[model samples]
Target: MDSSLIQRGRDRGYLHADEVMAAFPHAEDDIASLDEFYLTLEEQGIEIRDEEESDEHPVPETPPSLLGRRLGSHAHRADPDDSLSSVS
Candidate 1:
């Protein structure tokens, strides 16, 4: 599954049926595959809601992962003075 799509679903707490269909084109032809995809989404905490529902919720920024945090610490150590304010 595409991480971006997964993130989108996560941010919204739901995904349009069409979006899910597009993500798993094979599901269109295979009922079993579609069922499995739905199961996967449920496991991931995403819901399949109607597309008519207005998209009012703002997309939340994705936080850095633990690995990213570790790498970021190393980068800061390598350049202790490098900060956003220093970028001119």
Candidate 2:
């Protein structure tokens, strides 16, 4: 497990020590201590950028809900040729 990645998540306030440990169970033994991990982050000059700080575009609007209502009806219909009367 990369302690740096965990530290980054912690700095971003998205994760806590317990959550980090849960994600990387084996890391518990590998990491000397949580305090040490923080100290390392400080030494590395790593900082978490706020979500708003990043350039993000708005999500597109979803399709119309009425499309879902037609799905069942469409599936039950027969083929066009089968629905037509015998011409010969």
RMSD per candidate (Å) reads 11.7, 12.8
- lDDT by residue for model 1 over 1-88, one digit each (tens)? 5578778988978889888878777765788767876777899999887766745666866576765765664664446777899878
Candidate with maximal lDDT: 1
Q: lDDT values of the candidates?
A: 0.76, 0.56
* Cα-based lDDT at residue 1, candidate 2: 44
Count of backbone collisions in candidate 1:
0
- Among these predictions, the greatest TM-score belongs to 1
Error of 1 at 15 (Å): 0.4
Clashing pairs in 2: none
| lDDT for 73 (candidate 2) | 60
- Using all chains and alpha carbons, the TM-scores for the candidates as numbered come to 0.49, 0.26
Model 2, 1-88: lDDT tens digits are 4676756665653434454455557665767665565565556665434446433545856567855675756657666777446756
Per-candidate clashes come to 0, 0
